[model samples]
Target: MAPATVRRDPGTVKPRIRPSPAPPARVRCATKRAAVRIAYVFDHRLPSTGADTEQLVHMVAALGEAGADVELVLPRIPGRQVPSPDDLAAYYGVPPSFRVRALPGPFPTVRALEKPGFAAVGALARAVRTADLVYTRNLPTAVAVRLAGGPPVLFETYRPWPDQYPASRWLFRGLLRARGSFRMVLHSHYAMERFLRAGLPADRMLVAHNGWDPRKFEPRLSKHEARTRLGLPMDRPLVVYTGRITPKKGLLGVLDMARRLPHVTFLLVGSEGEGSVEREARSMPNVRVEGWTDLASLPPYLYAADVLLIPPTAAPLSKVGNTVLPIKTFPYMASGRAIFGPRSPDLAEILRHGDNAFLVEPDDWDAATAGLRSLLEDPETAERLGRRARADAEGGTWQARAQRVLDFAAPMIRTA
Candidate 1:
């Protein structure tokens, strides 16, 4: 190759454009004098759903904010590729200390569960060696914790496994293996009570509640504003029901409530798998089905709502729903909307028939309808109730939640 001599004109005023240096790589670091490391195992993989991803993001941020180095490991579907570099970069957008790692599963169902072999054991052991605590999500990660035995484990269970999946019994046995070594974190008093009856030691149990963002779901928005944002009738009251469109969520009861209260429009937000409530609610005219909403987009819908309905069905499908309180409770209350549900002990602490919330007996249309009518007819009472609900929700943030976990694991945290 022949080199050509380049000539520069002395009089030429070249554009003074400086190439933008590659954007500096962003890094999140732990702030504690001695960073506490936590391994958080959850159900989120790439392209995750709304609530699962939101909970994962919140926990990661909370742990990082509390000066802990938090790393998340979620199971990946079999044959699915790991997240791309750009995806990995986006995942790391969380606090610097929050790292997202994906483990492979052979089959789509329980492949993320293949962590007990020697190779898998060694990898987990190495990770656990540096970790002060292990926080596991559902049953799958609970199994992984039993295999990796370095740190004190804290299992965050939303539902009892055996009830949801018959196979869960085998998986739950793993908990017994880690019984003395691990602690269970219950989301509601209902869960605490149920697990206590199941024989888990009281000393091994702790409760951490969930919360919401006021800017997203609050009374700050007028009916007209919320309606405009959500594309609903500005004059009509909006009642919202969110969560998996399944029987346990009490969608049928919500539909019945909608039927009784023809004056209000129902907003059903959630998705279904093979057979779902969304499929069943298709015949309703007053009900609007929004399959699923991202965490960032939930506020408008919440603001547009006049009330948050939680008519849970009396189904024994899983211990998860029956025992654990739904995170929706905090958001529903935080939205400054009246909350109507059965007198569940898990949620009883927050509801007062005519105070912060309205307690309706399960499938009690007469009672639920009566409560709805009172709130709709009297705006003053509704506003008062809504305000009280919002005030009560302030105590349910993830920070408050993480503090409880730390308090329960104080012995291990101090050692770490």
Candidate 2:
């Protein structure tokens, strides 16, 4: 240092070199990456029975998987039986990301009956205010959310008649005329057409078919293995039907078929306790009825079956049977089992005769019986139809369905 100082002038002294500062550490804008928060409002309480609960759970899970934050909002009443979060997650197979928010309201029973009352409305409004979108299949809750005026509302209709209240119809028509901010999602082509005829704007309508999770419903065990595990007869040709044991489900026709074909075992997997349908089924030597089977236990039963029965009531034109497509159809198709059912427009949309399913005339026991017999006797045809049905189901998972709905609502969601 002393030698350098002597040799160089102070003004011309050299300085040590240093590396340029690293580019500002890359930062991701969290707002841009945040998931769209959705408030899923429902009029009914959870831990309930029926296909609606299953559909709602799976749809919520799918929406979460599709990058949307879903929170289930329902009325909360003191001293009511509500499922614990852990129980709900286990039942629905939902991830930790999915959540449930119960809005404080009057008693659960009263709130359920009068869902859009003042207290319920206040609760729903508060819940929806924090969300990017409000989704509901319950008409009253949908209307309430729409009126609350926070997030964009999406109303999904599975049945046409149930939501066609005179007041609701008038409100919907007015909303369409005013180009209201809400949208309607119909479950089937028939439902879309019905809503269109009912004065909903075509521009705001989306048709989303019911779907299943093949990973849940698909056959994981051999037929013999499943039958053995379930203690079902391994030798008999088993025809299975899984749903409420109601007459409107064409259980009468199934009973008739069971009587006609004594060799075939008719396994009816759901009954409302020991109700009339169970009594009728029990009277038949070939028919066996079991109480409700949980979702996890259903796959083995479906896999054990040779054919899946989907018999709608005699009145294919009835509101209960005709206007709505069965939610069970997708699961049946996903089970890789031949489906035999009446040829309604709802079924026709997804099923092809002699291809994925055997479509027969509605309420025609003779035709249904023949179809079941054909599936039982012809292994090649049954296998062919089942494989084709499974292939078709591959395209209709709950994930695909949720994505479709999200895509349809993308513009609205972004603006919201």
Candidate 3:
């Protein structure tokens, strides 16, 4: 029997998710219960440079670890180069166990023709048809797979869309309640709530947080060694923040902290390398902003830090369709550095104040400044917090995340 759906509010019914038996405790499992064939579809430029690409590849690799035969299907945009298996493997740092299929698409310059072309290819691909299900983060692929009567769709997302367009929203709403939607995976309960409010069924939703790959951080380097390797100062105390250097992520607030704490170095890794703010960052005497660092090279930067910051401001985020949970959180936890971040329901799912990290209210520069000062003043407490963060991080590995996803999709795979 399917899970029961209840009407919480008339004319604005919100959805709820039924939790699985997968424990909240340490998730170090690779049961390999049964082999499930999955064709993961995400149409984007090959050799992606964004964090989203990392998430997709890791999901496929983890699924493979859970005894699933997985193939990553993407569009072969005309005139654009497609990355070889080895290229992707080296860049993403994952075992090249699955095949990459580049289906035909329209000319790369033609934006409108691309989605239709990608969808048409998905509708006819043998990899998609033979698999137990078509799992996709791409909206076009999800829409295509269902309309063309392909396998079940596990449409996973962090938020709902088509809010402005009535017709598109209507179609997506139907797709959510459609017979072919096997599961709708969300990254957090905050995201789950967004979809629920968008009218998804209780049983149809699953919340699994994004995870980190432990291999990247293992054989951990010491702060002395890391700083030396990166040519950073040996004498200064560091407060580091990794990921996009945009105002939406509360960089402005972070910059203010640099002004207040002239003695402590505030480092911003992964800056876009140009723009007005970055120019201003270079002007600051206390702030040291570095250009975008690759994933493989990021651990050293993180390990060199005394504290990690994720200061997301009023960016139309937090328990919404936007990026509430930063991708760097897992790695920051794995690094065992004391984390200082905004206190929101979405972020609170992983980061806890006075527990794993030191939390402050979102968009509050004064609270953030005071929080960092407190952590710096008391070294013992900061070390204690870092230890707890590392201990808890053990359960949120890439493989562990894969096991949880497999556990949730077990029923559908078994029948397939």
Candidate 4:
């Protein structure tokens, strides 16, 4: 019967609901770690053979191990099926952390087809756009990414482009002058200087030597045991070279040495598809060409050798002549075997003559023969040099090299 009337001060304008200042825009502390997504563009097919393939495998694995989300952007043959990541990992002897993506294009083996198809370029550009950082060894691929206006790129140079591919000199110069966030990684100081002369900024250049997986290269068995496993004669001194059997690699000199020193057994552990170098070497009685040893099995051959030879020719005009720091050098050092090679500026940086290795004058076959003779005759000297080399290699593993690269790229990644 009675309606209760509540009387309030009309002046109490009920705290005008101000939306609690939107909770300070949620000072959201990011719970998950920011993963650095790296797009490594390479101009090669997966599960390929050669030093470049080996380097890519190690670099990708190392980057992954360094906590980066790494993916390899590679070329795919027009009609062929792409290999799975596991297949690639198995082929390269690397961990499954290294992932691969294929962009449809002409196979790298066909040098006539220099540039990738338009579709491939678009795909690569998209990948580069999404990545936090881009790393590439192929200048053409980097050029495509630059043209696409993608993220900052790091170009890793292993050779003097001007010398090897005179045709690409103009492209390389353009790359140096292009307006963008770009950096250069040279495999040797010589490479750095070459690029600097070609107009790259000094501050943007980094010299990172090629690296090896120490675990794979470490001497795992005794010399006799390794020789026995590899089916080598117990009496002869074994001299070995492991690399592509190209004329530019000074394989002819190795053959000559084999002919001169008939007593020593020369083992060439590498593929020999280029021209007649393999066939010629096979003709020699003292030279044994064991083609394409798997990465896992290479250590035993290195362990079996009394001395390792890196005999690239001194021809300044050859592809590998003036500006190559051989990838095998690091593994050779880690094998704890005496290394003998020409006095390449690149090699000299890591190897001191008579200290960690024996370096003779380039193309001086006489000096090379003499040095090999000395190493063969003096076990004490060889052992000392080998020990020094192994000590040097202890710090230069692929994982360590990857960490160095990541540290170098951190600033660029953050800014990107």
Candidate 5:
């Protein structure tokens, strides 16, 4: 059945739709039947697998593992460079049960609405209508999912875009309410709290933590072997900051840390987006900038590193980038390396001082360097911390993560 026409609230930035109250946990399973149809709407465009895509891939893979028939709705971007045939195969070959469909788009944005992105709304709505449930991983797609008629829509909002645009907050909130009687999923407790403050019903929101793909990041070769492969010096301690070279990622702080510890080799393994901090780290002999790596090659980099540096930039929007810990943390932990992080509210959940990770003030080179030096100088303490980190990561694999999503969505999945 198509959703009833939702009434617009004059005050809200977005249109409004009210979802039905979710049934109790016990009733969800008994009443619901058939294999759950889980639709993942997201972007799989190249340049790199952004955090949203990475999270989607793992979630889709896990949903399939949980016996849910999953279909991945990818944006069919034109003019964008597609991956090589081998890479394309690897990227799309998530899990057997998961399928991919591209929504053609080059949507021009007018005000807040993406016109081309809206092209996806019709097709996705049709697809969601057939499925047991509609699941959207990114914000742009969430708009389409909300507009579409479906069994039930459950959106995983990464951040509060409506909050960013106060002008459209009401409109977005209305649209959120109009999500065809669906649930909204969040990645962190921080995210959940944000939605609650925005007037989203607490029961309608859920926190699905990040999960890692164990295959891509397992305990590969030892530090010596891995370093040898990367051509990094085996003698000096190596601290790595992996991910895209963006401002919020705190690549500048990485340079500061490298300067503080000349004896420590700072290895950055990832591509640099426009306006990168590469220039600063380029000339330093102790630093190596390895641009763009395939997923297969990442294990060696993680294994070779003595510590993982997660220095997110100090900014209000930094929460968008740093709050939910990256999937890389899974492999970093599995590799049994000491991990360091910038003190941020979002990261507070994943990291604990002197436990799983060493948290320090963002851009505080003195404290960051001190933490790095402690890990480098005290091998016993480093090993103990690494052991704990690895244990924590191994427990948070895609399998476990998928299960969490299934359990959370059980209420809607059964009904859908």
Candidate 6:
């Protein structure tokens, strides 16, 4: 069943669609280089509530804001209403800066159809000469475009397909050796190192970490104001985790920590669907497991937290590489609250121990409990960590991150 609609924030204005063939690309005149015309090709249905979908919308919006003539080439499912620019902008809390070009493809309702639409829309995107470079997460699509005598490809991914995905690693390596200035973007150095070891030249791959849209987090509501809005308690100390309520994300650790520390109220604000994890997490006496809060309504819950908790488990997903870093880290940092999180290499890239955040051994439930308690007990320390974190977050804005990506890919885009 569809969730009830969230009332739009009154202060927010609808994105203006300038009368043109599409919205006129905003170009910063001071930039010496020409605006890079980018066709960001995607394989999924739009306006969905996935983290990757959010990342895509925010990334393209920032790319557009950074003075790129960007267009999104996506699949067209016959019966579905294509998500309009306003819908994308409004849903993601971003500016309507890029255009969407949807080409006819098979609807991915069945297992066999999931991979078909991507290559079709991608090939069509390249065939039309709509962009000087086709940027995609689809590695195979990148190869297809290059082999079809199309323009340059800037492939982006969180997975290190070049090294680990046994089937494609060999093919990708071959592409690297036979290529004409091939380029790729990875989300973290952890992923980048894999590509480097796999014979992708150091200069060919970039680590463009995922970022947050500041509008969703900025002009932050105060703790008191936010608590009142969310109907949370004022008398008790509250710690919050505002993402998926899965064991892979370390929710089981959160449950154990909650049981050990009954004095502190634990709130889990983003569970979707029912499962043993969800049932067990909700059944905890002191924990409040709210189901699937919409994007627009989630910030106040963060603002209301005394401490932002991202529990650390010994090993998530057991063997396969985990989603090492959580996207919530950005907003959690942006919230200006002391974050209590895991000590992992991926998070180590951005979060510092004893600097902006207090980190404890992942899977060390006792240590996490002790650390969280210590943070909550000391208000001065908490405030200092939060201030430093917020200051650091200013540098990690999506606008800033996007500019860096453009700068990294600038030379490649130019020659293409």
C-alpha lDDT of candidate 1 relative to the true structure: 0.61
Q: Which TM-score value belongs to model 5?
A: 0.81
Report lDDT (Cα) of residue 412, candidate 4: 65
TM-scores for every candidate against the unseen true structure: 0.77, 0.86, 0.86, 0.85, 0.81, 0.87
TM-score of candidate 1 against the unseen true structure: 0.77
lDDT of 3 at 149: 78
Model 6: ten consecutive residues of lowest lDDT:
1-10
lDDT of 3 at 222: 84
Candidate 6 colliding pairs: 312-363, 314-363
Q: 201 in model 4: Cα distance from truth in Å?
A: 1.8
Worst 10 residues of 2 by lDDT: 1-10
* Cα-based lDDT at residue 183, candidate 2: 85
Give candidate 6's whole-model lDDT: 0.73
Please count the clashing residue pairs in each candidate, in the order shown.
4, 0, 1, 0, 18, 2
In model 4, pairs of residues that clash are none
Ranking by lDDT: 6, 3, 4, 2, 5, 1
What is the lDDT of every predicted structure here? 0.61, 0.72, 0.73, 0.72, 0.63, 0.73
Tens-place lDDT per residue, model 3, 318-410, is: 333357577788999999988888787778898889999998877777777888898988878888989999999888888788878877776
Distance from true location, Cα of 51 in model 5, Å: 2.3
lDDT of 1 at 163: 42
| Candidate 3: residue 85 Cα off by (Å) | 2.1
Better of 2 and 4 by TM-score: 2
For candidate 4, write residues 1-416 as lDDT tens digits: 11111222222212111111111111111234456788888776666666788888889877876677778877767776787756665565666565678776644456556355532473355766888788988766677777777777888878877655566657766665753457778888877777666665777778889887755653477799998887887898889888776677788887888778888888877763435666676566677776675676688888998998888356532443543778888889999999988887778789999899988888888878877887899988888999999899888988788878877766666332
